[model samples]
Target: MPSEAFDRFMGALRSAPCENPNRIGHAALRALQDSRIPEDALPCPELQREPCALNGVPCEWLRPPGAPLQRALLYIHGGGWSLGTLKTTRLFLAPMVRRIGLNTVSVGYRLMPEHPFPAGLDDCLAAYTALLEQGFAPRDLALMGESAGGNLVLALALRLKDEGLPPPGRLVAMSPVTYADTLEGSHTSLIPLEHILADDSFVVTKAARLYAPHTPPEHPYISPLYGALGGLPPLLITVGTDEILFDDALRFYQKARLSGVDATLLVGDHMVHSWPIFSERFPEAAQAVEQIAQFLQGRTP
Candidate 1:
């Protein structure tokens, strides 16, 4: 049984004119996210947010009072691959920072239709490299993201392995896009009644083409599900049973386990896509945050 608030949020998503990404053009979608409440209005008085740049990519450092200094979290925001910014994800990031009790960096990587595939991926890689250069031991650092950001974190790990760099201690991907190829897995499935805030347009059409216009979607960097998962660090994945990417999460977890990676999957029954990001509105979101915190801290979730 979902909360009343979650039900209302689903209703709102169902009624939203731009709910179907196909109806709105890319520029309009970006403008829509831009039109949300200003950053200052969503106060996280308990946490301090400082804007900074990592390897020239815009990033934000979120620190709670007395946050541990030894370990840190590097976060990537999700918006297909063309939308979102540091401000857009602040709502959930702030609370996550406080709950996790660790300084966190939210990467504002480059977007597509303007930047394209390797550009955003490269920016993420650079951000991780910058963190390493800052002396955060690889084993003490963790990478986390939702949706496309989830894809990027996994891809970044693959890149690290390819470059013979040290792997992060752990990873948490929420409602990630593991299979980049539009035709694969659940991408071809019809949107189920339980699903809301997801559409074929955003994942299967426009964003895919814009982000990987030239490269094949199955490329290890684009869709990490196709990459070798062995030797990666412990992983935690969360997905809504309702979201279109549910199977994507399932398949990735299966492959990861088969590859001998210590992996855990937290499935949210009747939850919407990226539900954790709506901590303020949904109770399940807060619960998910706690579970993530526990997982990141090496406690059983």
Candidate 2:
């Protein structure tokens, strides 16, 4: 059973009218840009944030003073691959940045329905490589993201392996879109009841089509669950049982472990998609962030 707060959250979601699936991303970006939210807001005044470009890709760094300059966690924001921006991602990750106390770089990867497929991936890769060129060794770096961003974390790792680049020290994917086969034709038996109930399949399917257009849905870069998972970094994956991507996280963890990768899966019972990031609304969210902090520091959680 979930708490009263979880119940309230779910109730609100249920009562809220669903946005048009086709316009969700564009609408979100437009509304987000129109809002008055400050771009550099952090949890604490002591924390410093800098906007910079990595290999021509725009990025923001949220840093705790005196933290090692060599270690960084590259964060990718999620918005079904078409929404999300550096300002929004920075705000979303600010609390986590304070808790983790590590220098975190949030990538503002190019969005889709305009930029599309390899463009976002290319920007992420560029940011990562720029970090390497700046003297951060592969073993000291980590990659983290949620939802479509989570998908990118895995996709980027796969791309690195294919390019003969060293894998990062750690990876944390929260409710990633791993199996994109749902974008191919129809929703298959593999999709969970939770997803159907949430009506998230429509958004996911539409977003994927808009982003990948001509690419095969099963392409390892697009649907990482189909890719080989050997020789990657240690992984921590989290998903809510009630989310559409629950199976996505589970299947990926299973395959990764089967291939001898050290992987951990954290399932939030009765929680919705990306619930861990909603720290202020749920106790479960705070706990999840704590676990993430510990995991990133190589401490067993």
Candidate 3:
């Protein structure tokens, strides 16, 4: 059973108006800075957050007190490719930093409707490349993200493979938008119950069109679910039973496994989308974060 706090949070989120992305993108950038949980609530007080640029793309580095010098994580924030920033996602990143004990780089990629398809991907690729050039070995690095960021992480892995670059050691995608072209999925039936994302206005369809107006929907870089999954590193995916993209994650896991990729999926019953974002408020969220930590630790050399 979900916690009372989780239930209440879901209720409040559902009641909140689903605003237009064009406006939300800018409004969120400002509001989230003030809305984030207090720093005191973060697990790692010794975590040092520094704003920096990677390959010219803005990013923030979170360094836990005892983090290994070589091991690091490239974190991508989710907002349908339009909204979200490091400040907005600090709560989610804090736990990973504390539990996984890795220096984390949260990418602030260019958003859509402004920069579009390859722009965000390019920024992510550049950040990863910069990390490599800085001497972080492929085995010491990992990729992680939620929702659209999840989509970007998976797509980034595939792109790196295609470019003949060294692949990351592991990946964690929470409720990834694996299939962006269509709303075809088992979880589509939960549309009426989904509190965070809607079936039609979701950035996957709306903002995505603006993001990749010219790119084919099934293009591997656009919807990695359509691409080859073989030879990719081990992956861990988590999704909520009630989220609209549950099946997107499920299908991606299935494809990866069928293609001989090591994949694991954790389903949260009666939970909302990206539940791990609320780690401080929900026990399940904390559990999810622990699972990610274990996965990363197991892969780390």
Q: What is the C-alpha lDDT of each candidate?
A: 0.84, 0.82, 0.83
Instruction: TM-score for candidate 2, please give it.
Output: 0.90
Ranking by lDDT: 1, 3, 2
Candidate 1 vs candidate 2: the lDDT winner is 1
Let me know the TM-score candidate 1 reaches against the reference structure.
0.93
Q: In terms of TM-score, which candidate is strongest?
A: 1
Alpha carbon lDDT at 161, candidate 2: 97
Judge candidate 1 at residue 81 and give its lDDT.
83
- Clashes by residue pair, model 3: none
Better of 1 and 3 by lDDT: 1
Compared with the true structure, the alpha-carbon lDDT of candidate 3 equals 0.83
Q: How accurate is candidate 2 locally (lDDT)?
A: 0.82
User: In model 1, where is the ten-residue run with the lowest total lDDT?
Assistant: 190-199
Error of 1 at 138 (Å): 0.7
Give per-residue CA lDDT, model 3, range 171-278, as digits (tens). Answer: 999998887787666446778877777655574655567779999888888889999999999999999998888889889999999999989998899987888767
